[model samples]
Target: MISGVVVKHFLYCPAIVRITELGFEERVTDSMMEGEEVDKETVGNFLFGVLKAKELIRKPVYKYKDLVGSPDFVLGFSYYYSPLDVKYTNQVHMDHKAQVLFYAFIMEKLGFNVKQAILYYIPVKKLVKINYTNYEREYVERILRNIVKAKKGFLKVRQPVRKCANCGYFQFCKPKRVGNFYEREF
Candidate 1:
């Protein structure tokens, strides 16, 4: 099964998916540790009070066929459930949206009415709501197909130079340094 976290990482860099499939464990970075700390500190008091949700399930693992997702929180309301994810970053990115959309897709497949997804930015205390529509559904499906291809060793890395410096798998990737710039060597 493809995990939602892996889905998010695939969007960040397809090479990560292939590397993971090769059994190279990712080195946990300080930023990831900080994000976990932030989630632990802020999730309970801030999320519940702000969302005013009737029911809140923290880190509920949901599975549907070949996909599995454990979103930070699942909020239950009168008619539908919304997946909530907490990020330590101030800005929202496409990868983050993809992760939330993956969760929403899995929830829907399990017969839950999921109308929207929520992202909580810890640094800026920002909450962004994304409507789950056909566009998002198709987008997630396309990403899943790409992820499957990547797992089968058909991935081509096209990651940004800036991202490589901060990635945990940088050493394993072994990008060549050329005249003060790093170029990925396939």
Candidate 2:
């Protein structure tokens, strides 16, 4: 049985429902053949944050799945009934991160009171916490909207210029860069 917060997160987060599933493997696979590496410390911080959250008893599912695009990991906090994500980076850069921002968007749309988020910088060995406020929400919404609009405009959907680079997904998106975007799966 799930708690109220967990259910609220799931119910309101349609994007999570749409793509967080393993069935999105085709897209995930495509992502693997593109992109480059980020810092190791950055990666460690992300892994640590996820470890802080409660692990899924099931096959260690990601906290969010890309209903429209590839995000890194998406794990939820059943205790607080909150949405949590792990981002690994050496420095604090937000420009190349979309999936993490998108998670905040989905959390708000789904009705979860996302106060702040945790960012782990491995080299720095620091925890950067920020909330999912109205401003952040609006920003994420704008990005999502742009993506959806672009998809409809094209005869076939192509990936945006960014992806889960610092994610556990690095090995997945390397061989080549597809029509701009591809999914990465192990």
Candidate 3:
């Protein structure tokens, strides 16, 4: 079963999905991967703050079929719980939203009111609150469905030319170079 982290990576780059399908595990490099330290520190701080204000569950693991994930923090109120994720990036990404939304979906199905996904950006020190819209939900659903299909013997390796440099698999892939702004019109 693919977890939310796997889905997030797959959505970030199709090449990542291919790499995982090929059973390539990411090796820890000497240098920090982007946002590693910040994620750790911020999560700690968030846990502290939330625990002081209200009941909070840290890293609660939930599994729904092929999807398995643990949200960084689940803020529990009298009748509902909200999914919160700590990120090091200054801005929120679709992958972040998808990860949180997946958690929210699982919580909602368990009869909890999950109205939005919250992100705490470390650098900016701000909470980027996003409503769990149907559109975003559908988007996440598609990503999960594709992941299932890939597990069933159908998977395409995505190698975005522009993203090769920052990718952990860059040395192995050596994809054709492209500018960051490069885009192919469908």
Q: Tell me, by lDDT, which candidate is best.
A: 1
Candidate 1 residue runs with Cα over 4 Å from true position:
29-38, 177-186
Candidate No. with top TM-score: 1
To one decimal, what is the Cα RMSD in angstroms of model 3 from the true structure? 4.4
- Backbone clash tally (model 1): 0
- The local lDDT score (0 to 100) that residue 22 gets in candidate 1 is 80
Over 1-186, each residue of candidate 2 has an lDDT whose tens digit, in order, gives 112222222222222212323233223353433321334334533554656765422112233334332223333565432333333457665542334455455555555555655445445666555666778767765655544443233223223446433333234334245666643222
- After superposition, the stretches of candidate 3 with alpha carbons farther than 4 Å from their true spots are 29-53, 150-160, 172-186
- Provide the lDDT at 76 for model 3: 71
183 in model 3: Cα distance from truth in Å? 12
Candidate 1, residues 1-186: lDDT per residue as tens digits?
Answer: 899879988887887788788888776789978769656556755777777888888889998888999988898888999999888888999999999999999999999999999988887888899999899899899999988988887444555577888888887877766555566533
Candidate 1 has an lDDT of: 0.84
* TM-scores for every predicted model: 0.88, 0.42, 0.76
| lDDT of each candidate versus the true structure | 0.84, 0.41, 0.68
Q: What is the C-alpha RMSD of each candidate to the true structure, in Å?
A: 2.7, 11.2, 4.4
Model 2 regions lying over 4 Å from their true place? 1-82, 95-97, 152-186
